[model samples]
Target: MKKLTTLRTKVFAAVMLTIATVAATAQTNGSGRLVKQDRDLPGFTEIEAGSAFSIKVSQGDDIKVTVETDDNYLDKIETVVKGDRLHIASMGMKNPSAMRVYIRMPELKTLDISGAARIETDGGITGTTLEIIASGASKVKLDLNVELLNSKVSGASKAEFNGNASVHRSEISGAANLNALNLKTLTTNARVSGAGKASIFARDEITADLSGAGALSYYDNGQLNKISKPGTLTFTPQNPGSGPSEEISASVEATDAGDSTIVKIGDIKVSVREGNPTKITIGGSELEVDDNGNVNFKRKKQTRFDGHWGGFELGVNGYVNKDRQFDMPEGYEFLDLRMEKSVNVKLNFYEQNFNLISNKFGLTTGLGFEWNNYRFDNNVVLLKDGNDLINDNFLYARNYNKSKLVVNYLNLPLLLEYQTNRFSKKNSFHIGAGLQTGLRIGSHTKLVYQDDGRKKKDKDPGDYHINPFKYDLMVRVGWGKLNLHANYSLNTLFKNNRGPELYPFTIGIALVSW
Candidate 1:
């Protein structure tokens, strides 16, 4: 019986030894040098990182992770998935500058970060709810489009936010700071303590509680209720203080000066001179009332213009054939696009306007970047055969989950713009039409699929016979803050006779403007 027990013990020890050998071989090659590695992990909705590493998260259909680091430290990083949470940390190393981790999942519900780790999202995160918790002097930045956002910052951590949200609730303590003035929310509730500072934007209602030496700044004209104790509160230009905190004396006076009757009310002064004009001066600004009882704000005599070219735009991309039809005319069905998936993005970074007639009409010019994606509807890929693009379906063993072609251009536009109001941006109607020219900067094709239960992405960048230069007629129309833009190509998508004779166009609304 003793011999039998001893035999079982030896077998158990051998199994443990074999498992350790396999794990060590997987982390390094025969040379004992560590290398870059990818970990196949189960689905997780929560992430917890406790190290000083650069982490980027994005939305995807499946969970994927790629860890890039120096060969010496590859074996020291640890990624463990337990339950519905993924914990990332380093065993003993501290602040490895060569480490970068890219993580993607279908959705994310919660993120917890400690230490000095820096985390960011690749694009806007849209979901029902998102919760962010940061401590230990960490940093987090996200572009959010969510229904509800809950953020907590402590221990000198900092968080930056942009995009839009329906409601936001945040708590800051210690010396932490929350900078969310660019995140437009419908309603907000915030609490600050210790020496933390918070800046937020709200549209409808805001309720805040402040204590200690913390400060709060908000961009909203909505209803506000605050409980302030030693902390300072500030208002941004989107909404200003309605009245003075303390009551002050007021007076009115009238006088006559050289055939002009002058009336003074508070800081406003009105001057009415016969056979001239009725002018009102408030501080340094001047307003003139014409014969028709129209009050117009006098502007500088220099060339005045209202430009509508600088903004961020999003739209769908499409191409029409030679006959101006979307339907492919036989032998060209491969170029067909999935309209909903083909996207166009424009970032108008700079703009200038020169007035031609008052502020109503002006010549506008701007610099922008145009990113166009053509997602294919069929299960095929475009291959460059000489100078022409041909369709092929034999490159992959499995069907791709997503396939798309991307083109980027540096764009310059010259437009004639008109505005209905000079300075009343809230009530103005604007229209701009112009010619836009673009220089193609880059092009690529991307494919995503599953290989043996693992998600994989393949990117191939090449010219693909795309036109080097493009010209388009552009139009922009908007009322108040809502703007819509459209573009129609004046030339074929590809060089003459190189590919299908298709003209690309886009129509979308401006998501943001200045």
Candidate 2:
């Protein structure tokens, strides 16, 4: 048994290592100058700027950016710190994103930047190297491209490419959403995330290789040519609906375009790339994937079956750190202080594979019913004293509670999952992630307080139902079937509510696994 566990660990490690190697080889870095990075987070790292926007590279360096209050600016760096080996992540969460650093990077070898970086490379793609390394947090975005050197991305990496991308060979995390049209080379790796499509082209000498977990999808609309490397390809095709077609457009390739890339697909996979596809015309609706799109397995509504013995879960989790700059509402003549609260939760069908996704880390995906939500409420004291109560927003405004923030949703989500020790019995673990299309199941508010606080009338915040589709991240750590867990709602707490963006997170013990 111990040997089996060790083997599982080894296999899992090997899989992740392969992915990292693939992403790393596909990234880009140039010149040998260290430009400052502008961290967009309120508590993230900053970037340095350059005068002429020259290219600079660095190997092995670490930087930390703390985005604090009252200060958000950008600057450029002219030099790269020599001999630094760690990467300080640049979070891209704010607007007017800019930061300047004082550093130098001359004759550097490699450059690495991770975390949420709103990166804009002014210089052209030259002798630059790019890669995704080990990370604990999950990231997801669209419309950015990292030069692929070797990629071992475990978090969500997404972007759209209008230009051609050049890559050697790299692995992609199931969370990576890449859509590029101009054909080029994509050396094989593991899973590709999302429902987005791109025109894939490999040099005739290059082959489309795939390994590791998740479903495989290969489809196109051209001369479905013969695969050169037949032995390297694998597949077992099964289409539930009118999803996967029989052919893909052939790209003009060199003689060694290897064999027809084989596709080894699991359940829940679809592939459609570029141009209106030829298909049977039925019911006046063209039965084909076009700019209108097809090869998509989108259920108008996918709910649970009765007697499935599955219900849903509700959660509330979030943090209320002390607001350094407390901006009271307009014309508030009185105010008070108290600890804040953040509420977040994931209520999914209990007895279903969806429950198998315990968002304890990174991202995850599944199909089931869910009513997940989160929010934040200030720990408010109506006034520091009765003297300040007259002008306070909490005290004077009769419609203040009406401004209370609430965000709830009913949704169908596409998720990506990254686990740490999923294959081990002694220390196996899983994290749940995925998007949710929460149809407003129900919403209610409570006025919670301890007797140590002052007395007030028992007023319910009333009920509200808003349509919100949300993405969630949850991390759980445990052995076997039981784990300690917390879920954080990644969406704003209120869409139409009249308050600040409130995020809710919930924590609880769960019996979950991959």
Candidate 3:
């Protein structure tokens, strides 16, 4: 019996020794390393990253991926390129010790993030749409230039946007927080049963629908547009000199009558009867009453522009001939070009300084850069001909597929603007007309074609007979950031008879106003 027990003990010691040796070898072979990958994926439209990892993204012409992780989990990190989208995800990591990924790609159309991850970026993100869904204890921080943003948080997650954005729409139901800075338009629908909060700073209008016990705070330069909440909602407008201001004041007085409470503030009144609900009325509109007995006060909508006179404006335009004139240089004719497809895109960075003559009248002047893209209808190439630019039809034998002209200018604009209700508490109406002069800084033409299933491009830079100086009549009319703009150039696109005798004009919607 003693010998058999000793034999079992020896067998157990051998098994344990083998296991320790294998584990040590595995650890040595699976140690972490720094990995870098780069990809040139043009025409990729979107980005989707998920899993338990920290990701940092930037903007570039191509996609660059860098990872630092243990070799044991190196095989678990995967990057998949499917169709027009690139996805990076981490798998097989139940509880990862350390992992970091950095991605750099071109401007995307959409960015989607999910899982228990920390995603961060300092600018360099420009898209039309952004979506984030966090189900774990995740966090996201970004400075984005997006027209629309949509986010949803279901766990103890947090999301923050610290740059200028046009619109933001969000929904939160967990112990999450969504904070935005320099946000223009915000619309939130939150049902927070936990300790959640949503806050926005330096915004224009906030439309919110709140329930549960969460809190929503909005700090705007203007008044709140609308609020429908069953809980607490607070809005504090910036002071006069800090931003756009509306003169608003209110005094509340409470009276007790027959076991009831009656409060009066300005022209608004509220009655809270015992064993009944609270009632409120402002002018002729009755405020919606909630079961929580919470009272909300909102000013009438005001006509104010957030970040006015000192921000950036990005927009695209449709360039078309105002009057049909089929006159071109001899031996050159316009090709089959779709009028709707001929597009011009512009980006302006300016600072507006205002000189107020009265409450309703003002003069505004600003300096900015105007980057213009004049895409041709078809593959028409431009050639220099003695201080003139004319279409070269002989270059079509190479079967050029795409061609466009790009121009950049330093511009200065002066305008006289009129605003109704500028001193009133109600919304304002605005109209501005001005003259703008531009100095040509750069001009070029590009042609693109396909060669052996691969795309090739050529750029030609010159005066191209383009005018060295240009001026235009510009007008803007709208209430807020959303305004209609028109600019008619008084000069032709090229020198006199240097090219087609076509006057250039642009009609488009301005996302920001002066």
- Model 1 residue 510 distance off true place after TM-score fit, in angstroms: 0.8
lDDT of 3 by residue, 1-514 (tens): 3463355345434543443343344433335454544434444666677676788888887767777677577778777778877777877664455667777777666556666678888455877787766654578888777777777765556787765456676776545767763444434333443335676644444555576545566654445332335554434345233322233446654445557666776567887776666778787556645578565554444344222232234333323232523233344444223334344443343344454655567776655567666656656777877756557856565677777777788777777777766544125667889888889999988889888899999998877878898888888666555555567788877778666555666555543232
Of the two candidates 1 and 3, the one with more favorable TM-score, higher being better, is: 1
lDDT of 2 by residue, 311-416 (tens): 1232333322123122333333122111122323333322223323332233333333433332222333232222222223445333322112334454444444
Please identify model 2 stretches exceeding 4 Å from their true place.
1-113, 128-148, 160-167, 180-183, 186-199, 205-315, 318-514
Q: What is the C-alpha RMSD of each candidate to the true structure, in Å?
A: 23.1, 21.9, 24.4
Report how far off residue 162 is in candidate 1 (Å): 20
Among all candidates shown, the one with the greatest TM-score: 1
Q: Following a full C-alpha superposition, what root-mean-square deviation does model 3 have from the true structure?
A: 24.4
Which one wins by lDDT: 1 or 2? 1
Sorting all predicted structures by lDDT, with the top scorer first, yields 1, 3, 2
Clashing residue pairs found in predicted model 1: none
lDDT of each: 0.77, 0.33, 0.61
